[model samples]
Target: MVMENEEVSFADTVFGFWEDSQVHSVNSSNSSNDEEENYDDEEETFCTKEKNKAFWEEQGQLLQATLCRTSSIETKVRHATKEALGELNASERRCICGQLEVAKAKSCCRNCLDRDIRDRLLSLGFNCYISKSKWNNSPGTPSGEHTYLEVIDTSNSKRGEVKVVIELSFRAEFEMARANEEYNQLIMKLPEVFVGKGERLRVLVKILCSAAKKCMKEKNIHLAPWRKQKYMLAKWLGTYDRSTMETLPRAYTNRPQKPKTSMLTYDLLEKIPGLHCTTAVEVV
Candidate 1:
């Protein structure tokens, strides 16, 4: 009977030890799992932060490089464009379209402004043309038409005619609603007036589109089709037609004040004998 009691106590001790060991093993396993999970989370967060920083830095570098590049032709065109914009804006001609108010509200008198600039560029002896890009709605962006200026440089005969595209509203092209701060800053780096070679503009378009993609991804927003690189490049680099209308004579640009007995504004009295000026000259 003593042997039996000893055996039973020994069995109880063994079971207790086994139970405690199992509990400890489970706790250790849970601790290891928790540590691994925390490590993974931290690593992932760090990677994401580093990726975002690198993307913005890369974009800034690309933009700066593209903007810094200039050729003699590009510089001349840029200067002429800036001067034209300044003078045109200073003397903003109201749209004389039938619906003046509607035209002004819609395009802010863009027709006259564009025409005036084109004329000025032509007078400046640049092979300027009003180019129109039209695309059909396919698997890509929607069908639309865009009008902008272009200058063809034939000075580099060895390399052939170089096309320098101009965008009066360059910055607005890539603007997005609800865009992140980084994306907006990149957009701001673009000049309000962009005058560059086709290759330079193409590179800029790619950079902006990629940055836009990252920004929208971070915000969990779907990137639009038009914002894609291909679509944006199609604006200036794609197939288009150039309207090579004849520019007026430069002499016509400079009209003299009327002689003492002549017309001041138009040659109405001279051209049309039926029209006559007032007997008394009244300066208003």
Candidate 2:
């Protein structure tokens, strides 16, 4: 009996020892899993920080490039404007140079300007004059308006006999109308001279102004400095206040005719018999 009791006690001790060993093994495995999870979390956090840094760097570079481009363009425009002023003629018959603050920048690009100008002129019942020079692309700043020179035919009388050199500083509505009338009158008189009778007739058209605009998908770049100046002049005249605006006494010349040419002024309009320089605005 005692032997059997000893055998039973030994079996109980072996079972208890086996159960304790299994519990210790399970705890060690749990600790190892917790350490691996912490390592993975640290790695993910480091990667997120690096990604944020890269994104900010790219954005900064783009902003800097844009600012540089804007500064460069402004500088060029000012230079171009100053250059235009020096090109005008003193007699006002050979060259036209002037400046004005435009209402807004042009909406069209360089490629579309010729079409726009042609369309605008045609709508006004005048032919579009293609400029003699190509687009000016030199990098220069413009401080003021545009300049132009045109040799126009006013009469058909002698088929190239009577040509007027007209120089205009601005493109105000009144100014454009006046110029167009003068040019049209010259053209009308051309047929009276009997074309093909003798001399060769050639009309010269030139654009002598430059304005700079940025090239972009949404905005077009074909800008005429002459047009801008004209626009500015028109706006200025409309808003002119005698209290603040200065005026110069201008000596006006009579519309030149072959037999009779006279120097007249606005003050002398009432005293002069056929020399009144007043005419109604007529659209041709």
Candidate 3:
């Protein structure tokens, strides 16, 4: 009996010890798993933060580059505008086409106008070239009243582009022609005016040529023959779709729409007898 009891007690004690050890092992495993889980969570959070930071950095760089480019372009445009204004200030006024303003009479003339226009165009960094022969006066036409100017397009040399001659002729065409002739003669007399590289005579010549052509075109008018009369009636006309160009390489067609005709219709000085007018007698 004693031995059986002792054996039973020993077995119970061993079983109890085994159960305690298993419980401890389970607790240790759970603690280890929790630690690993916390570590993983921390690592994931760090990675997400790093990715977000890198993305924002890249975006910032892109934004900075965009702003820099915009600023540079704006600066260039501002500089160009200022330079053009400066040239304008230096230019002397002359009666190229407009009525001779008495205020500018002594300061302005054909020579001054030509130089001012050329200088303004050149300051903008354009390559100017003039043709060998200048534009001629076309009498008895819309263009008859304007001075002509032609300029070469150095920007698009591949297209062999030439600026349309501008004509300025609101005032008197004859007066403009005489002034131009005098100016040309004066320029020809000055070797430094057109033959020197330092003076940029080539560029000036081109600018002048182009200006002359444009002025001519602007002053050009279409004239129609009067009934049985040798003289023709004049009317202003245009070839461009718009007053100012919005885009380059203008679309041109040989068959263009004609401008609307303008004429005064005289219908007996009165529309239908004015319902019996009151008569006043003049005493002789």
Q: Which regions in candidate 2 have their CA more than 4 angstroms from the true location?
A: 1-11, 70-74, 77-284
- For residue 222, model 2's alpha carbon misses the true position, in angstroms, by 43
- The best-first sequence of candidates by TM-score reads 1, 3, 2
- RMSD (Å) per prediction: 8.3, 23.1, 26.3
TM-score of 3: 0.28
Candidate 2 lowest-lDDT run of ten: 196-205
* Best-fitting candidate, scored by TM-score: 1
Candidate 1 clashes: the total is 0
lDDT tens digits by residue: candidate 1, 1-284: 45644555777889999999999999999999999999999999999999899989999998998899899989999999999877655552444443343222224455555666788888899988889898888796877778888999998789998999989889999999889999998898889889999998988998899999999999999999988987888889888999867443222122353556534666786679998687897889
Off by over 4 Å in 1: 1-8, 98-107, 246-284
| Candidate 2 lDDT tens digits, 1-284 | 45644555776779888888889888988988999898889988888667645543443344333323322322332233323322221112110011211111132222233233333333444322322322322233223323222122333555543322112222222122223222333223222111110011111111111111111111334454443433333222212211112122221222343655466534465666667566699999
RMSD (Cα, Å) of candidate 3? 26.3
Supply the TM-score for candidate 2.
0.25
Best by lDDT: 1
Error in Å for residue 21 of model 3: 1.4
Steric clash pairs (candidate 1): none
The global Cα lDDT (0 to 1) of model 3 is 0.38
